[model samples]
Target: MAVYVQRQLDRQPERTYVIEGDADGYWKLAQSLIHGEPYSIYTPPRRVLRMPGFPFFLAGAMSVVGEDHFRVRLILALSGAVACFVVYLLGKELVNETIGLIAAALTAVSPVMAGFSVLFLSETLFAVTMLISLWVLVKLSKVQFRVEDQFQGRLWSVLAGISLAVAFYVRPSWLLMLPLVVFILILSAKEHRTAALTRGLLIIVGFTVMLVPWVYRNYQVTGHFVPTTLWAGPSLYDGLNPRATGDSDMTFFDQENVLNSMSEYEMNQHYTKRAVEYARQHPGHVFELMGAKLVRYWKPWPNATQFKSFWVMAAVSVLFIPVVFFAGYGAWVSRDQYLLLLITVGPIVYFSLIHLIFVSSLRYRLPAEYSLYILSAVGFYQMCFSSRQGKELNPE
Candidate 1:
């Protein structure tokens, strides 16, 4: 993938520079952390810009390894390796170590998850943020009514909130995580008494603090106080509707490029209003879209590429025929454990809402897909264990 991105850059560095900034604004607010110098927004090919956090993360990696494109790709690969381990941590907390190992192994191999590891993108960043959030959630869920541990629960819950807030920074859609946080607090209240409330409040406070600066910056420049990326809603509306005219092969970014040229500021204004009005006037369309996108979320499989994401989808479909049922069984068997369901349901609900309300992007669906794998691993690892009980294994 680095080879591909570098080749594109070599051929037309001019096109890629726009990713660093656009006509709207610069990263002036977050500049100290993300870039070594005050840099203008440059257009990165569709591949790199999708992962905004990648350049910053990889820039650090480049500083250590030598400032080159290979360094960025190397860093992405390494972060992905670490992210798989993080998924293992989540799986271990949700199920058992065997499940954890299985989840990690699958993460390393899964086409969708592994595919992003090659780009200078934020898919890897988003994955790390989300997995860390889940891991922190699992820790905070263990919070109990030990009054003496007030500070402990508070700290853990704050950490969890910070994790969630960071995820939103990495991928703005993660803001939807608060609904699940609400459920977790309510469920935990009975067990932990007032500390649960304290935990919840602390979590909210933490997230608010983390999110304030971005909101303030948006307010400063745009006067609207948007949270993350400014373009997603209007971009999605135009990209998916009749206006985009993208074929099945084109990506969300490709459609956006053409739409960006064809449409102007006034069009985005119109599209924004129309998107809201459409959702209001035709609520059924929203539900229909949600269902369709959810299917796409699963069907085309995660590891789609220049050569194929649909074929990977087919393979996953065949593999998951039994995987889903076993997970349903395991989840049913673990019915009393809200942790399992909370982890499973949060991303699904969040992404479904994003798809229905906003524009659909394959990358937008990533966090939810990876979250599902932990549960899938529960079934896969368990079946592998049960079917092979008492059987001897040979080391390779």
Candidate 2:
């Protein structure tokens, strides 16, 4: 909290453009939402360029606090705190209380996480929402689906779906996780297949209920049934163009000059077509690009060009090495706990695959990074205190 407060006070004068174009875009979007006007100041008025979750939250904070940047940072700082708490709960649920405490402590002081809290980006909020969804899914996986407990199990599944729906609103990429989660539930509840299917149906119902209004709003404005945000095509093309360097490049779209004359939907279609054509024409280059993207997504250092100090980047990169090592060891040791392994590894896999097709950056990997803390805690506990009895000293 003190760190966040100090950073906010130090940077308060430049709050309006702290993160440059992205932060300014979010601020404009929030103002439009608060005023009940179209979100055109940043993108096309007819299309929703960005997801609505963080802007809505920021709009509420702005309304209550009278549009002050410090107050908004305070809200995000609170979210970072909540993310730490959620990591603790997730670690406890997966292993034991000791592991939970360790994970929470690491998350509380993580440089990447802390840096995000002081900015007006959606990464903090998205991390919190993703953690909440994972915690709920962990609870659901543990539920015993007896005939008498079917209602309780169904309720838990629905709640997990609702949490994930909130996460999807924050970052539409999470929508890809729905089927994966449902499959996991089905596999875990193999003894009661019918009950598992019922729970899955209820989850889908809950998710659809939460998502309908957003879809409807997009359709009404754009005259098309756009389920997610309208930037998918451009985002995909950003990584596929000939000048692509495994990081985001906005120059292709600018060079095309489609923004001035085309509708948002048309622009999206054009970009999609262009990216697909590129992939078709240069299959080997596409494969090489994906390999580079995987490296960028998982590399331990901050890859953004703004972090110019080599020594500082190397120091931060070194910090992540221990976490990565222990997480891999923890995953290997806990391989028998299939559901636990899924909970820890699912987000990493999901995000990696998505970024391979789009752009890869540290910011895009933030939501999954905390989950590694859970595995790291387990590894730390096992290495430091495991006895020769082949039993955990602090079993849940």
Top-TM-score candidate index: 2
Prediction 1 global C-alpha lDDT? 0.61
Per-candidate Cα lDDT values, in order, are: 0.61, 0.82
lDDT per residue (tens digit) for residues 204-322 in model 2: 88899999999999888888888898788988888898888788778666677787898888888889999999999998999999999999888888788766488857766766788
Worst 10 residues of 2 by lDDT: 39-48
TM-score for each predicted model, relative to the true structure: 0.76, 0.93
The true-structure Cα RMSD of candidate 1 reads 6.3
RMSD in angstroms, candidate 2? 2.3
The segments of candidate 1 whose C-alpha lies over 4 angstroms from its true place after superposition are 1-55, 65-67, 191-193, 239-270, 281-288, 300-306, 309-326, 387-396
Model 1, span 239-315: residue lDDT tens:
34433321122243345564455333333456566566666776666666666665655444443344355575675
Backbone clashes (count) for model 1: 18
RMSD per candidate (Å) reads 6.3, 2.3
